[model samples]
Target: MVSVAMDAVGERLVSRVERLRALEQALLKAGDRGVRPAELAQRLGVRRQTIYRDLQALADTDVPVWNPARGRWAVRQEQYVGTVRLSIHEAVALFFAARLLARMADEHNPHAISALEKLALRFPEPVREQAMRAAPLLERRPRNREFVQALECLTLGWIERRKVRVLYRSARGRQRHPYVLHPYFLEPTAPGMAVYVLAYEESYFRQFVTLKLERMSQATLLDERFPERDFDPVAALQSAWGIMWSSSPVTVRLRFSPTVSRRVRESQWHLSQQMEEKPDGSCILTLRIGHTLEVLPWIRSWGRDCEVLEPPELRSQLAEEYEAAARLYRTAATADSVSGLRPSSGRHPRL
Candidate 1:
């Protein structure tokens, strides 16, 4: 098994508990060579007495801290959190993220639970309590043997830089299709949504696709290895509204009514977003994103206050949906009953 290390990326926000955790990591890395209290105090910007007291505290907790000689303290441990440190704010953020992972996991995944459990030890107090709770909370989820095996295969393939053969079942159909893919990233969608893998298929052409884990029935880590690409998943997904990535992006234009215009103007939803205010109090929001599929749900959430203005295909699609719903409402009104809404027997009305 490979030991994977993860660290937060952000500015430091100091806390006593955080400092103690950082100190533990320092000694863990220092190993038998050890470190002097004065050096640790200097590095941590604290007094030598503070470092001495902290070392005592570590020993009190049965941390296996010992000194070979005067002022030289070292920690003995098999597993070391090399360079592990967390800003107070980062700890809180990670607490929420671990909570998200637990809530969104469909299967009882031991790997995810292990990660949460290990991460829980780094935080202090209330945040630690919440993060620790996630392990058991996620453990109680339904167990799917196929899904668990598939995930393990994908994880190995990704870490080893090997191709993965997956039997992917599409959402629209019952049939499962085979694909030999280079697993680039294992990405979880928004809160309460399924997890997906951004993989590249190099069969006939260079094609990258997002395959949902729930849709994968089986996965096998292939013997053939693939060379690592000099790719940054964050940058590759920059233009994506969600997980769909593309070299060429399409422009999406949305106009919001005056009622929700202020709400839209108040928040910056995406980095690629630009707004245009009209004299009539309405506003147009233009964005460049990979696909319209991911943005459709967001636009629909705003109801009639949001209008799909550009990319005629998208506008037409929205028009068709709204018109279909309007017909159902008319049918309900005619029936004069709560459950009276009849399915549209007519073709979608024109916008």
Candidate 2:
């Protein structure tokens, strides 16, 4: 496994690339109306010197951009470029993410809503308002700074073809894997949800792990990076449910009460999830999870309303808990009865 230091450097490099791209876009839009360099910086809320450096960096890269006047700069129309088109699945994911951000008004981040508006610009006018309306129900957690940092480092390493050492803390707390991820994609899980770092955890085994930005502590990028490495993030998460990286796949089945059935059907828990109708008006939901631990708490939350019908292990766990609780109650009843009973005449004689 690679060292953790490389991950830090690589992330910084990726952030620089993205910053440059945004600056480049702003310059392209400035046009012959010729936005002043200072004004461009102001638009981006950055210092003038930073904007100047961006121009120099763009020039250094040999892009045909220049300062036409004392403070004005512009990129040739040919320099204007659009990002790759997103597939429908990606668009839907974005839609949900946009909705989640819109709801983050309570989190004191005006940017969440603003970001959603920016994304809406990509869709048609009619669809835009509808997407905005739908955003709140999909509101996700705010962007985690640590995860963002990890992602930034990973991106640079990928672009530079450098390897990074990630100090990962596993869920079990005992297994710490040094990850060598071939970074390619950044996907937002659900709408408005905090994004996760999707990369390959290369150690004794090569497997994909979604490292929550919040979970990684004391991350630093290394000088070594990876270039020309190819991997698909979607395919890696495709076989999984939620974020658990399961090597051996298992199918999970749940039956929910009628009251919660609509709620279950309305939202997707997994891509492979299939819905089966029960004659008794309950919802039978079936999906495969890489690790049952991820869904264990969720099942327990449903209380008496849900049942784990498949995956004998999961069922057994629930059963074990149920039996343990029953035994405890029975013991408690016996104790209560003994305590409530009047002292026997024999006890008075002994006293």
- Count clashes in each candidate, considering only residues at least 3 apart in sequence or on different chains: 0, 29
Can you tell me which runs of candidate 1 are displaced by over 4 Å?
A: 1-83, 202-206, 229-232, 337-351
> For every model shown, what is its TM-score relative to the native structure?
0.67, 0.52
Query: Residue-wise lDDT of candidate 1 within 1-351, one digit each (tens)?
Result: 122222222223336668888889888778667899999999999999999898888777667888867778887542222444787787668767878888877778887888889888888888678778779988898888778877878777776578988788778988788888898888777732677788887763277777888778768889797887777777878888878877799899999999999999999877899999999999999999988888999999999999888999999999999999999988777776566655566787888
Candidate 2, after superposition: displacement of residue 347 in Å?
45
lDDT of 2 by residue, 1-351 (tens): 266678988997897788788887787766644678777777777788888888889888876786666767887543433455876567768867556545532232344555566666667768778766654443454544555566556656554445556667765787555666655554544422444676665664475556665456545667654444456666766765556655577898899998788788888778778998777778999987677876787788888889999998889999999899899978887887788954345545555
Where does candidate 2 stray beyond 4 Å?
Answer: 1-96, 99-148, 158-162, 172-180, 186-194, 202-207, 221-231, 245-248, 258-268, 323-351
Residue 117 shift from truth in candidate 1, angstroms: 3.3
Q: Indicate the residue-level lDDT of 83 in model 2.
A: 55
**Top-lDDT candidate index:** 1
Best by TM-score: 1
Question: In order, what lDDT does every prediction score?
Answer: 0.81, 0.68
